[model samples]
Target: MRQIKIDYRRPNPVPQPAPRPAPAPNQGRPPVRGGGTEHPGKTRRCNRHPGVHMVLAGYNTEWNTVRYLCPMCHAMGLPPVEVATGVINAYFPEKGYGFIENGGPRIFFHLSDLATRFTPQLGMPVTCRVEANDKGLIGREVTPR
Candidate 1:
């Protein structure tokens, strides 16, 4: 009978590759005020309340831009408007339509109804003159405050 001798030695561990270094700050586009590019699903600082981050409240269109709201501003409301004061509840830049929240029902508005050339954003404070039409309440002469 022939007996075979077996060596019980462990093999040496394989070397791992070094991790890649992180990208430089603001490598490409201009640095955002907060130090990074705006990302989807990330909260942004409120224009009215710089210290507060806005929340995603709702979306007007199925695939359009999502709307944002400031908890403090929404709760406290903006300054009184001779006609009506409200926040831009929803805005669809592509579709040229949006809604305003003025304490009652949402007031419908359109790009043509806007008195200013600047575009409207969600949660923007605005003043509007509301008028009743066959379709319902519509906002006219809408201007950002």
Candidate 2:
């Protein structure tokens, strides 16, 4: 003779929140007035820096919510170069280097471009950004769409 028993004390899992809508042509905020270094309700600042001004409103693919891309970050307290004008002089594929004609020495780019559709042109008017990483500067998404 054989006997078998089953226990039923385990609790049901919690339901996660609903995800946001995506696959949008342009789903973000319009440009605000007086876009500069100072964000809303911030005491610390520097007048010299005019932090990065991004036109696109980003949604965190991870959290699935719309979050603004700060030109710099909160740690700096000072603003970033929100508005920048320059050109991509060369793209050295062999050396994994890129140069900006008018931008400074730190001005370089590495293309792990997630936005695969974005094809950059050399010596073209590039109104984009360089995000801060461990290596220092990394170019981000482009604008004027």
Candidate 3:
């Protein structure tokens, strides 16, 4: 009978990967919109919904104030900003989408954004509230003037 060698030594420890370098402060972060720095002490509560926290939406250049939008109010189709007057720049009845020229920039709107049951015509004046989404600015609660 052949006798086998009995090894009782512990195995070597596995090598670990090198620690990743720490990222610089806000290095990869996207630039803040509205061209203003967030103030830590600024009020975060929503005006309409006192219990809810409002999101930093944008900066009002004219008013020199920060604009905040309440997520609840926005979800309910409530205007986040003051009603803006614009004219229908483009419309596609089949596509159900259009753009409005409101002096600063063209605001995109969908047919469902209309407040009344009326066909939008070219150059038609409209009042709408601007809202921010993943795709940038969009007009909501559009009302024909």
Candidate 4:
């Protein structure tokens, strides 16, 4: 007999992010450029498509793989922060895969129709724009919205 050791959950689909509700009339505020506080009388951005916003939520670490991880910096407890703010990474019109190059490291992103223009170029100039509503960084944009 033989046995295989591998991540059992890898085969399953990545969990989707919580959805954002559409803003009601006079129930929303202006969109913020970078991270900021939500004004008392402000709503989020105008999401043509609201609900079920998913992000490439993963992190990296310098911990030793061979050794057991310490309580600190293990799992989602220490979610990695980005090094750069807004930067484009990749784009594919056909496959529909684009990425925003945050400061810390590269991050994977899924763009809709408008983002298809900014395909992932190896070394092209891309403005990695991160879309944030009431929620943190829900969606990413290679180009401006």
Candidate 5:
């Protein structure tokens, strides 16, 4: 009978570079834009939806995400701001939808903005916020009333 031993381990662990020095206080702080110079009453534009609202809730550094309080939601509280209750003038399920506010404009709603799980029905009342795009005023955050 014979016995033999074999070694398969590395002699040393890989070397690592020295840690970087901590930056000075406010050394790398980003510049503040549209602040201190702009009108005091005016709210800053939201980063996520530009030219909309700027009621900031807070920042999430871990996900590099920002939580902004919807200005419409904040101002109106329970009822969404600028929400127009209207009856569906035309709605083709899984296609396109449009509604006409009482004595107001007839805004078009896309299938993508539907927040309700149920299919839209014509002549049914709906609550939604009218948003403008390149095409014109369209409905967003749409839901059945």
Candidate 6:
């Protein structure tokens, strides 16, 4: 013979507060006009340096983003030259050696010379800043296109 006891108790339902009435429309203040129309309360600023009013130096169509020269970044008298474009002819990731097709003698580059956020790939279109030395043109700041 076996005796078993079963206990059954229903759980209580949670109480919910009554729904709030809808707020009256037009409670917010009207926007004041001073800055550009694109952003009502916001003003145009340097993309690199916040709080710096950007000056219209030029348009960069390739990047599709406006270029801004901050006083702290472009304090030098001379502006940087345009970046040169070429296909990466070869790249040895293990050895950190690479070449670009710049229509001149084989342009040599090292992994350290590439942009910090960029990784060079063989046959990838890239833009670089070049400097000439006795050996040949050395590519620096290599970035993919």
Please provide TM-scores, in order, for all candidate models, with all chains considered together: 0.43, 0.36, 0.47, 0.28, 0.42, 0.44
Model 3, 39-97: lDDT tens digits are 21334566579899777786565423345688999999986554355679899999998
Clash pairs (backbone) in predicted model 5: none
RMSD of each: 21.7, 18.3, 23.5, 18.9, 21.5, 20.5
lDDT of each: 0.60, 0.41, 0.64, 0.36, 0.52, 0.55
Task: For candidate 5, report its TM-score.
Answer: 0.42
Candidate 3 Cα RMSD after full superposition onto the native fold (Å): 23.5
User: Which lDDT tens digits does candidate 5 get at residues 5-124?
Assistant: 333222322212344466567555433222221222335453345767655455333322223466654665632224444567887665566654433556788777877776777776
Model 5 regions lying over 4 Å from their true place: 1-81
- Candidate 6 off by > 4 Å: 1-82
TM-score ranking, best first: 3, 6, 1, 5, 2, 4
Runs of candidate 2 exceeding 4 Å displacement: 1-83, 93-97, 114-116, 133-136, 143-145
Q: How well does candidate 1 match the true structure in TM-score terms?
A: 0.43
- Could you tell me how far off, in angstroms, the CA of residue 142 lies in candidate 1 after the best superposition? 0.6
The clash numbers for all candidates, in the given order, read: 0, 4, 0, 13, 0, 0
Clashes of 2: 4
What's the CA error at residue 58 for candidate 3, in Å? 13
By lDDT, who's the top model here?
Answer: 3
Tens-place lDDT digits, model 6, residues 1-145:
6444322221221212344465457444343333211122333454356777644454344422223345655775534322345679998988988998744456788988877676778777665656667887788777675
Best by TM-score: 3
Query: Which regions in candidate 4 have their CA more than 4 angstroms from the true location?
Result: 1-87, 113-118, 129-139
Clashing pairs in 1: none
